[model samples]
Target: MLVGNRVILVTGAARGIGQATAVFLAASGAQVIIHGRSEESMDETVRLIQSAEGLEPLRVAYDVRDEAGMKLAFKQIKKIFGRLDGLVNNAGIMTEGLMGMVKTTHIQEMLDVNVTSVILHMQLSSRLMLKNKQGSIVNVSSIIGTRGSEGSAAYAASKAAVIGATLSASKEWAGKGVRVNAVAPGFIETDLTAHYMENKKEKLLETIKMNRFGHVEEVASVISFLLSDMSSYITGQVIGVDGGMVI
Candidate 1:
């Protein structure tokens, strides 16, 4: 109940880690907002949350890279919730290819989704959060961002940028009671990573010290902690849910 009555928005929440986070946040008593690129996706997420006895999270849709869409989404948020207490910038995309072989458009798309959209969300969300003079934000980063990986150059760069943004935002807003941090997940089992699980299953397992892929709930728990008062003193940190891969 740490987040009871708190208004929290989770983007890219139609499925996968985003959906798990939304469910956890709602279960923790937040007035959760579920966002996705389509209504069908958000609807499914809402059903899942409701089935779990969690609050019926608001369903919002937006193209992460579109500034206008984000603005309108926030407008709707204010109208419904009146204030924003927490935000999870979990919306992102991954395009795998060799650094040299990756097209310019592909890299740009990755940056636009994983990095630029995050900044835009922070800007729009922070304005509402700052009004209350207290808020928390959790950016979903990736292990690739810190350690690098084959065929993930652009994705790595984008996630790395997320860490940098989290750091800077924490410093810039901490004094005003806003905390920003990030969770760097490693080899999570989600639709996004289904291809990897299929194509590089054993090799990926070998790399994980835990000898297993992470569950979305594991990462979601950490995110909930970071967004709650439990981690009030923590900010500008990139905590890895990577099963000791870094070790």
Candidate 2:
């Protein structure tokens, strides 16, 4: 019960790590705002979380990149919860190809979804958190953000930006008592990575020292720690839940 009375907003909460984190937080007694792009997916996640013995999180649907829609959703959040204690920026997209071969639109879309939206959400959420003098912001970065990988320049770049943002924001807001941190997860067995590792299993395994893909719960546990008082003195840090891959 790390988040006994907190209100949290998790983006991309329909499935994969986002869904897992929402359930993890809810089970710990957080009032979670399960956000996703589709209403059906959000509803399913709500049901799944409740069935798992977690609290019934509020289902909210909004594309992270939709500024107008995001603003409206925030207004609704203020009206409903009156306050927010944490935020998990888990919504992201990957665009992979030779850097030069990637189209302009592809690059822009990835940047908008993965980088720009995160900054916007942090800015908005920070305003709400500042009032309380206590809040946690966890941005889901990737191990690739620190290590350059072939054919994933855009994705890596966006994640790298997330790390940069986390560090800067954490420092700037530390005095105000709002902790900002990032979780750089390694290759995890989730739907997002299925497309990349479908047939390149051997190559992916060769890169990891553990030689095994990580589970969603492994990442969620670290996130829960960050959101809890257990990590009171930690901020501006990138906790890599990567099975010792980059250590």
Candidate 3:
């Protein structure tokens, strides 16, 4: 119940960590907004939140890469909720292509979704948050952002850019009652990472000191902390929930 009466918006809420965070926040008493590119999936997430006795989250289906869509979505949010207390930039993708096979389009898409969307979301959200003189933003980064991963150069680069932006924005809004931070999750058991686990489950576990993949709930709790008053004194930092993998 860390976010009682708060308003939260999460990207990529159709499934995986985004869905988990949205549900968790709603259960904590926040009026959550579930956003994704798929209307059906967003609806499913809404159902789950309702099933858990959590508040029914508003579902918004829009591509994060669409600039106009982004503006309209945020504007619509303002029309509905009037103010946003927390924002989680969690929409992202990973393409598996070797360096030689990677194309320019793949790189651009990653940059657009992972890096550019985050920058613009923060820019607009900050303006609204600044008016209320209180807000929290959490960017969902990855361990690859810290340690470059093979076959994921573009993804790693985009996430690294997220970490950089989180640090910079945190500093910029320090005294404005806004806190910007990032959570770098490693080897999470989610739909996005299912393929890798299917093939290299044992190998991956060996790399993690905890000998297991991180859970979506674990990452969601960290998000809740950052969004709650518990983390009021913390900002501009990237917390790793990697099970000692990145250490």
Give the residue spans of candidate 3 off by over 4 A: 197-199
The digit string of per-residue lDDT tens for model 3 on 10-32 reads 99999999999998898888999
TM-score of each: 0.97, 0.96, 0.97
lDDT for each candidate structure: 0.90, 0.89, 0.91
Off by over 4 Å in 2: 197-199
Model 3, residue 243: distance off in Å is 0.9
TM-score of 2: 0.96
Per-residue error (Å), model 2, residue 238: 0.5
lDDT comparing candidate 1 with the true structure: 0.90
Give the per-residue lDDT digits (tens) of candidate 2, residues 172-213: 999998999999999898888887745686777777898898
C-alpha RMSD of candidate 2: 1.3
User: C-alpha displacement of 211 in model 2, angstroms?
Assistant: 1.7
